[model samples]
Target chain A: MIRYSRRAVLKASAAFAGASTFAIPSIVHGESDRIRVGHLTPLTGFLGALGTYATLGMKLAVEEINQAGGIMGRQLDVMSEDSVNPATAATKAQRMLEQDGATVLLGEINSASALTVMQVAARNKKLFMQTGARSDALRGKNCNKYTFHTDIPNTVMVNAVGQSLLRDNMVKDKKFYTLTADYIFGHDLLAAAKRFFGANQGNLIGDELIATDVTDFSPYLLKIRQAKPDVVCSNLAGNQVTTLIKQYSEFGLPYPIVGFNLNTADAWAAGDGNLSGTWPTVWYHTLDVPASKAFVAGFLKKYGKPPENHAWIEYVAFKMMAQAMTDTKSTDTDKLIAYFEKETEFDILKARKAHFRAWDHQLMQEAYPFTVRPKGQANDQWDFIALGTAVPKAGEPLEQLAPTQEQNPCSL
Target chain B: MQFGFLLEQVVNGLVLGGYYLLISLGLSLIFSVGGIVNLAHGAFYALGAYGCVEITKYLGFGPAVVLSPIAVALLGILFERFILRRFYTADPILSLLVTFGLAMVAEQAIRIVWGAAPLSASIPPAFRGSVFLGDFLFSRYRLLILAVVAAVLLGVWLLLHKTSFGCVVRAGIQKPDMVAALGIRLQPYMTSIVMLGVGMAALGGAFFAPITIVHPAMGAEIITVAFVVVVIGGLGSFWGVVIAALLVGVVRGITIHFAPAAGEASIYVLMFLVLLVRPRGLLGERIEKFE
Candidate 1:
């Protein structure tokens, strides 16, 4: 072993101490070199298909932002964790804030987990961008000062579809047989559908709250056959959606189908092009806009498939956050929130710009009616659904699709 | 509800019962013959489904349907010789814990290989459309499921009751030491029984794969239902499991017609009621361990 002089030892110790002193704060606060973003989403489980796409969208945004000289000359770094459930989400949110020193938090497809993350964000005073959950409570009773919702909520989705139903002459005095999933998310969506149908003079002949695990939809299908409804409004989620669509097709029921919330991935999974219906969608891959085309190209280059709505929500969420941070020239949670509340517009790949409402922290974006092509008429595998312009007519104001200030009364 | 609808519900219940019968039969056999709670039974089912998917992609649906279960059964033999054989003499709880750990690893491995998204196999051309039976319409694929399961149940019965290998297996389950003292080795019989039980579970998975969503968590989803069927049927009794599975399927189907949300909940309620009345199960036999 070699022995060192006292002066050398002292100098070495000083250098080590100096290096650690500078490195520790950088890890916590993310100095001028990098900005830490904590991404909490389900990377595994039933909702994982959408979650994985959402993570990809986050990555795409982070890469583009870093390449374009990220917020205040600092690069963006995302630390992702699988938010499996509400309990896991709450603990991870706290750990992300305290242990990881994350300056911002994003993601959550499950509404219950989103609510938990929202509470954690409020308590920690960190800016949390809610990405995938579509519960109306997030914009109403559950809305908090710290959280900002980027996806379209249940009420907005219903209202958009309701308008389309009236315009397309599908809802006036029409009888509907509703098959709602038996869960909190399903209950909320059913409530929204009821409100829409009630307002539009639609009659519900049969209503069934189906358990999520119930694979065979035949019992309910037989009921629908007896009830003879005009259309069967499906408020189902997860694999339940695929099951219903497949079984319904197999049954050869003549009732027109309409879905409140249908993911792009669900359509793709219904192989042989079985899924077909007029659905209220937030965004489709086939939107004829520059941002959408560019996003589709870049996403295809990286992921080898067109981005789904979950991917769109996550990609748009990061871009919107980065825009706010750049505009304010700061990542301070309060300052950025204040800037967000001032009605800043974001180009979210739609024809019109989307912005956060001052009252509720909801993103006011364009909603469209999507119709899937028939199996015989399909061009490519992913070219299943196309945007319909009849219902939410071209150039229809986005404000009309969402609830007014009086309806929500959200006070942050 | 109309009488026609009620009749339709009965048919539906019977079809659902067929799946329960297929799944619980294998679990009951393994528990009784092997004396090890094979918690990885569902994982074997999942592997069978994934195997079917992979095999069908190249060999088409016909050959996949015939060969996937056999391939998974061979895998079960390897699993028994290497992993399960070590825990044979240990406490039953050790086997349960070990199988549970294996199940978790298998599910993760499936995710790593097949990805986390739900996948579905296209229904074969032969079973694509519906066939009308009298006034009611029924899925042709469902009819195929009922027929296959019925034949399988009959085959299992004949094998266990008529064959010499099955006789040795039964004797080993009841009196391993006595069977050994008779100048006969039971290790091969135990290995064969495990293979048969696991292969039966794989057949259930292979057939159900075309109808249901084949995902990673499918094993977790089916395991609880299998255990409940086993417990409610009186653990080791083969006919008890069959009767219980049928009862569960019919009750669930009927419950969906009356109260849609009560379909799954009613099964557990029935399980609880059965356990309360007879802790051993509906047809449970008092089991004696061979010293």
Candidate 2:
């Protein structure tokens, strides 16, 4: 399968040998004749680290693109907005379009906010590259021609996790129990997990939502005793994930606890080997590629610390957008869309192995299925890396996954 | 639940309840003498945990466990003089904000002192593992926690209810002018109460350090529960606080055994329901009426 995908990519790249043929169209409106991009980020939130990285990634890509002869002699200019909330993201999206006259909108780190930004793109006819947000619905019924996802959506994670579980023979005869965060990420992950397990060989016997009612894990600990499910899939974040793991250990609750949304730097360090062996799906692990390796080394050299998921995703998404702008050969919306479709392969450290999917406009790159097992750097929760398997290029048919109406009742 | 399981659940409830009683005992005592809410009560908890880490890192586990709270209380006096005194004359909400600020300051200070990662703490070498209790089993660490909390609660009960200083504090809460008229300076008593409440919160945090995480934000998460116990048991009622603690703990224990998803919300819900029926609370003999 890997060889086949590699050969197919080689053939396609050979077919489009002259990569510079698609240069940004000349600026007629007395503009700088450069590609102007907008970044929507959350400077303050639980996912703040990721938002910062998303912005930085765009900066790095723009810098690299401009340095390498300015994208057919037209440099990439970019600006970002702090899309910390829905209203702010909507405002930022509009400002990026009308005020800044941004040619493209880089999706926010938060999925709910990304969806809100997608609406703006559809109306304004601006290209949207979604890199961070993992909403499965964005590629489904909510799919618009203008919106493109560069990161693996939550459902893709489910497919990767489920497929890997099946491959490892780890999904049989187990009763799954979900300890999920009560939000879009949690709900979507749980739904995708259920679908994945059902198709393979497992049953979601019992589940619980950790939200308003659960300030402590004392009750959930007791239910674990009562139900005694074979697997506990928890979608907890930050300190809460560490809290649950510690409490579970204290109670001596013995069961394989898989982390569904445990994909952050803080959780990795805080878990202290307790969350190790728990499986999770993520877009890029810093240990996977040379670009990532170099980026991590550079980041650590600059900041005296290692990079995590936030930095890795930002690095990939920004570069992809820059490459897209350069390939389109024009700042014009109609021309850019044609350019994006034609330039299927994105050359970057993150997605150099694979090409971008044209169907959902989601990145058709490989996902490194990581388990939160022990032994890594200190004081960080991003201890997870590619454990045993590199899930090969399996083209995720985004639209093939059920639409928003089919998935979310309220979305319809 | 089975017969053995029910007993185990009760035991668990008692252990969980003991922490509430232990922490609230100090808050109640402090409230009786000093009017401030001591919002940084959880900070004391975190301090205890950090003290355990620092002391344990330097000294052995045994010495650290004994010395951590003493170190915290000694430091607590300084905090009382520097931070808490200013808030005394301010609005009650000001005390709330100041203490909340103090809690934030302490969290960051501790993080600055002990990085963002959680450190490993264990039950003192003497009390590791579990003992068989019929069909159920109890961790020695948990059993040790029970003994410690019980001993502290009894010690507090004696110090407050059975002593002259306790008598003055009790009088101060009900009739502060009378205590002042009796020629006893209120500052020393207020300082002691502040230290005592903070010390208890620290002890709970220290004991939990091995079992729960020893990070900065933990105190923020559990402070609401501490407040729940304070409100439900009546603002200044000692015995009321004790009963309320047990009720809250047992309810959590029982519910977790049944519906774990609602573990956190259950405590507040129960507190709300209690406040609705008995407007004063479980034991509010004479509260300053707000509503």
Candidate 3:
């Protein structure tokens, strides 16, 4: 029989607790030896589907970087989780930097969540690679020195699709009714759309602000019928966009539908025959660029599916971060931020290299307008989108599609 | 012209309400009979959507919608036999917790099976597009859904009011002790009620899959509304649930017309107002077991 005095048990328990307390810092120290990147994206909710692809793309990037001996010969450690909502995202971002020794932060598709995370990163003075959020306000008035945005903003998306609409003579004098998602992202997109409409002489007939969780668009559709607009524009985001697309097709309204923002995953979820009109995308799997093709092939081999646009952006964002770290040879926030602010061009699996605009820290990259391929023309489920030529044409500057200094309120 | 638009919204809201009734009535029935809240009811709805989407690839939409709910009803048998049966006489919280856990497990299982991306399902070409009836425009597909819902409502109402099975179920809901004293075994009746409940939820999923995003969390999305409908309608009343579902839909539509940003929140506001006015629900009958 084993016996122990009460004092002896107490002393042993104290020592065990003391040991674990000491052990945690050492584990954190070891983790700090590597570049600890905290990644957050919505793994559940409306943006969850895109976040899944985002995580996969970031994982593939991390794997490739580690295989090539990692950034500056230290392995990269990524702690990824669901950024659930704006409040939770801020909480997790703070915890990642303060407690987990994460030197940098990355990943968020929801613009609202990204804004919260950006605030966290700024407070901690850590670099946040705002990978997939497209709200213009993040780059405009809300822009900060610590956060750099990679995806095309609302302005770029509107321009990308707007140019196509203009070429087809669909914007000028057109009676446009818009359905905007009721969130920071949707509101920002609607603002940008309004700017485009005002500049192009498009008549704004009516608009509705739709809540994010709305699954049924029947009532809204009835209103659209009542308005009888010449063009129906969607400023909705995530799964809501897919829902609207599906229901819109079901109603089969006479007016053509177009969107300022549409992720490839959302479009794919709208299915083959349902999607019509034009939409702007950051990147698609079917790009003719060699690097993109390679990335797509590698992704297909690993996951048995083509990578969505969120996945592609996360992949390039990580690679961009790795390049910045390698160039500067330090994870120091100032050095990394300085390196990016210098406008060092990066190959983002596109025809032209993309660079972060110095003032706004928004990535100046080519965006594309896409329409669904004709029925029976698509080779596979993911091959439905017919990607348009890169906007800003060959001779035009990439910044032509992005917001100008006067238009963007960013002062940083 | 403004009145015409409001009228269009009202009629459309009614059609949407009919769809909501399909899922909520089943939830009400299962709760009425078993004294279990069946938080996993939405999971069955999600499963029905997934099942229908999968079946549609092989069997076409018409057959898939029919087979998917029937398939889910079979699953309800297993659910009742293994999980739900043990909780019927237990504490309500225990059943709630068990069903809640089951809902998560079902959602995760679906994620594993279908992947996280939503599977696209479109309305059949023949049924796609709008039909004009005087000044009102209606989606042809939604009208078909309304017809199906009407038929199901009639069938369920007739089964409950005009049949011997319904008599025993009604008696079992009110006094399981009395039913047992009368030498009637309520276990089989409980199982049938659960099957019917989950099956109807699945049917709602199968019909809505074409118009809504068919994703894993879809069940979680719907369960809240189903609960709202059930609570607002009063827990054990069939007509109460029917009225509440339609009321919720109409209220949401009218609210969206007036205040677009508050569209989703309108249903909860409606639920809150109804509960404030009638604590027992609009038509909720008191069941002895629940009391």
Candidate 3 per-residue lDDT, tens place, A1-412, comes to 2346899989999999999667767778766568899999999999999999999999999999999999999999999999999999999999889988999999999999999999999999999999999999999999999999999999999999999999999989999999998889999999999999999999999999988778999999888888889999999999999999999999889899999988888889997799999999988999999999999999999999999999999999999999999999999999999999899999999999999999999999888999889999999988989999999888899899888888888987
DockQ, per model, reads: 0.26, 0.16, 0.52
TM-score of 1: 0.92
Residue A144, model 2: Cα distance from true site in angstroms:
4.1
| Superior by DockQ: candidate 2 or candidate 3 | 3
lDDT of every predicted structure (CA atoms): 0.82, 0.69, 0.92
Judged by lDDT, which candidate is best? Answer: 3
CA RMSD per model (angstroms): 7.0, 12.3, 4.2
Better of 2 and 3 by lDDT: 3
Q: Which residue pairs in candidate 1 collide?
A: none
DockQ of 2: 0.16
| Docking verdict class for candidate 3 | medium
- Report the lDDT tens digits of candidate 2 across residue range A1-412: 1134678979888768745333322332357566677888765444554565556555655666677888668777777767977778988898778766688887576667888899999889888877777767777657778887776667666655665667766678778887776656567767778777787779788777776213346556656666778877776543456667666655566677766565555454343444544455554445556666787776666546565565667666766665655666656777766766664666556543545455556666565667654455443444444454545544543234322334543221
Give the lDDT of residue A394 in candidate 2: 43
Q: In model 3, what lDDT does residue A196 have?
A: 95
lDDT of 1 by residue, B177-207 (tens): 8998998987777677778878888888888
Ranking of predictions according to lDDT: 3, 1, 2
Order candidates by DockQ, high to low. Answer: 3, 1, 2
